[model samples]
Target: MAAMLFGGLLASNPAEAATAVSSVTVTSVNSGDITASVEGKSELAEFGEAVRDEAPELAARSVSDLAVDYRVLKVDMKQVRAQFAPGVACVDGDGNSRAEDVIVAPRNAENIRYELSGDAQRDPNYDPAKQGNRCDPDLFWDEGASPEVDDDPAASAPVRPYTEKYASACFARKSQWKDIYGIYLEVSYNDSCWSDYVTKYDGNSSWNYYSVKAPSSCHIARGTYLTSCGHGVERNAAKGPVVKWDDWAPAADSNGDCRDKGISVSVGPLSVGGSYTHCEKQNIYKYAEDGKMSSYWKGKVTGTRATQHQVSVRVAQNAGRPRWTHWINSDACVCYK
Candidate 1:
């Protein structure tokens, strides 16, 4: 069951030293009696099979709980493109284009940015002499990166940032997305997916520029097999919370046709609706054979202080990092987006 708890009311900006609290209306659209429709349940099962086809190690285990949630959203890729750093479309050395893997955050896979060490001078955990860690590939923390496991939660937490241009990204985080039926993935608390995000992504942000737009036959298979099929929609669900595995946009249809391979999809008037139905069992471990799913949504995001909650990230000291370093963030680098 998705409990209605407060999403972290963070500072207005990530790198800020002081943390403040404010009472705002952060609500979940749909509430109790959440049940996964038979169709929804079937979708989960099929996704499990697809995953098994890809990664067999995690075959179906006896599940204690499972529920698939849904969200009806109007995705504006142009808006998404505005928020993250710029990226280029290039293929890999193997002749396979999987370059988006290098991005720190899939939403904005290229041109990742964060607070420089010099900006944290006032921070109690800030240090002057530290190892030189580069952001060319892989996101590394000096110390105290994981809040739940870290010795000092105040010192740092898993940080996700939007570009300065698009500050007010996920401001009014909907505690529950009303229209959907599924369980709330406590993504921030989950250890497995969060770690997977760090390992798979954060490499190099270059991919071959080609439209693998949805193929005619959209084969719903498992595994991270993305292709240059139909024009694809790349989205990073709940970016700040965690790099959720379930939020991945399905691979382009293989048949060179936009038809889903006999799968039921929620069709909106605008034609953008699918992530709400598909769920990879691996990402969502809490499985319930029979139950309802709920949703979370926040709207009217703008690049402003009133509309945003800030999240900051720092390195864990133990991992090749001392205390501090020498670098500065541009004034433009600070914003609510």
Candidate 2:
């Protein structure tokens, strides 16, 4: 499950480095039992405030770009039980209390560790002799660009100045830590979706401009794709090498429609199909107003286009991209060269 734990406090503008502490309330529960408390000396409140005011862009980051850090402290439950339900008391089916599960001083440890790293090493063996890592959710907050706003009141988008920085800070955090063996909690974060709204859309611009509206959707799938086929602009689930790849935007006309025009794509690892090939027939279609596919494409190629990369059909061409047959489950759809 994803958890979005926003700090309830707000700080001054975060254009500069300033630190302050606020009382942080942490509530933990298992099954239906909840434990809420205001811990001492936690930077959570300060971190939460900085996240809201300073790092608007960080709020737009996907769940993949988030990490949680902090420590978990334990105390003897036996002392408080006499006044409460001392020890691990189990409620019987008839609602009767059983004291067998209760323990007074059952092993107490100070802190635990956790991380979200991909290699799985983030989860370490717990040792009371060692200081385990804690979950500090504030570390994942980035105070870079401001949020993007659309006509929609809730469309708050974050700007990523650099991709690597976003990935390193959130996407690849250590998963877990080892403090006192045999106890751990999996790290989690909320998935922030796109908030920018589309105000105006121009389907027919000399430059094919769509009024350049605000961003409204989170980039669901982004990264490089390599296939024996070339990339098509149609949102096809099966046409491209990877399925459901829909994050690509229209390529600027200035780039010369590098791929859609059959020009070569950046040649890189030959992981899919070694070497380049001409797209004997290349096209990019769209789902139209009438809910029908667009016409076939008219274009040309010159450079050595690589396999399975997104390409755009230029507006200058009389015809647009081909009807995405993959939409109809037709194997006739072509993706690679």
Candidate 3:
């Protein structure tokens, strides 16, 4: 009113609109682009909602944070938390690393996982953290000669971990009675050991076995702490022994040594009974000619050398039980001492 003069200017051309927009400097770049205040909008939430509802696909295409898909706003935190609870990693076997994701065979997974990590409570082959069977099952030691828990004979026996997949002990077998069950053990380091463990579907089924021959000389003697149990079959003059063993120190015994970088077992025509033959040792120098010192056990000594030898034990099919021999390192044998 004092000057009684007023003038109004409106944007009439694209150049004018651009000049007006340039006049207002952008304070910040939100999301991937600059964000500006919209006229007459107290809060940006309402405008964002309208844009998303009208052009959902377009809104999903981000242009700064000013516009976003309704899906983003509708995230369920609880669902997301459950999805990533335990971290996941990938592994491959079957000699293929780039195959499509498949549900791992739980049975094999349980064994492989336990072999990699499981609690081995007893059994000389046991390692609490590293659960490879360091000792062979057939190479058991005399209870009086080895370690025990509270003098409990049963406790000292190796405790096989319960397999999560099979819902039973890692070692399981079918029983004599079709419906009954039994535990399985691997002696020759093969699944054939399970043959006797599984229930027989037919009554006249025959039993097949895999056996190892004793060494000719004691590879593992009293003083040899690094020695482990091995197996080979002693054959006639023209035939050779079938050798299978674990050379890995921690698992050189009957139980498979799982920790060794590279370990394997082999089977051949080695007879357990053929291992021990003509096995006699005499410290003749210590005793006179009339009194010859000799050591003997109930078996044949097939072959012998200064520090290595092979002995044989009989596998009698008596008491309806299959008897097997312990092809052990001399240090692991209690028969001599």
Full-model lDDT, candidate 2: 0.20
Across 60-119, the per-residue lDDT of candidate 3 in tens digits comes to 444334322111111121122112211211111111111110011112111111011111
Candidate 1 lDDT by residue in tens digits, 1-337: 3221111111223322122111111112211221245543443343334334222432352221223222112222122221221221111122221111111011212222222222123323322221111111111111112222222223244433211111100000111111123322111000001111111111122210001011111121111221111111112222222111121123221112122222111111111121222221101111121111111111111111100001112222223211111111110011133
* Clash counts for the predictions, in order: 58, 38, 31
Deviation in Å, model 2, residue 215 alpha carbon: 14
If ranked by TM-score, best first, what sequence of candidates would result?
1, 2, 3
Residue 103, candidate 2: how far off, in angstroms?
29
Off by over 4 Å in 2: 1-36, 40-46, 49-176, 181-195, 203-337
Q: Which stretches of candidate 1 lie over 4 Å from their true place?
A: 1-35, 53-58, 62-64, 68-147, 151-337
- Lowest lDDT 10-residue stretch of candidate 3: 187-196
Highest lDDT, which number?
A: 2
For model 2, residues 51-166, the per-residue Cα lDDT tens digits are 34223654454322321222222322122222222122212122222111100010111111111111111213222111111112111111112222221122256432210111
> Which candidate would rank higher by TM-score, 2 or 3?
2
TM-score of each: 0.20, 0.19, 0.14
Residue 179 displacement (Å), model 3: 59
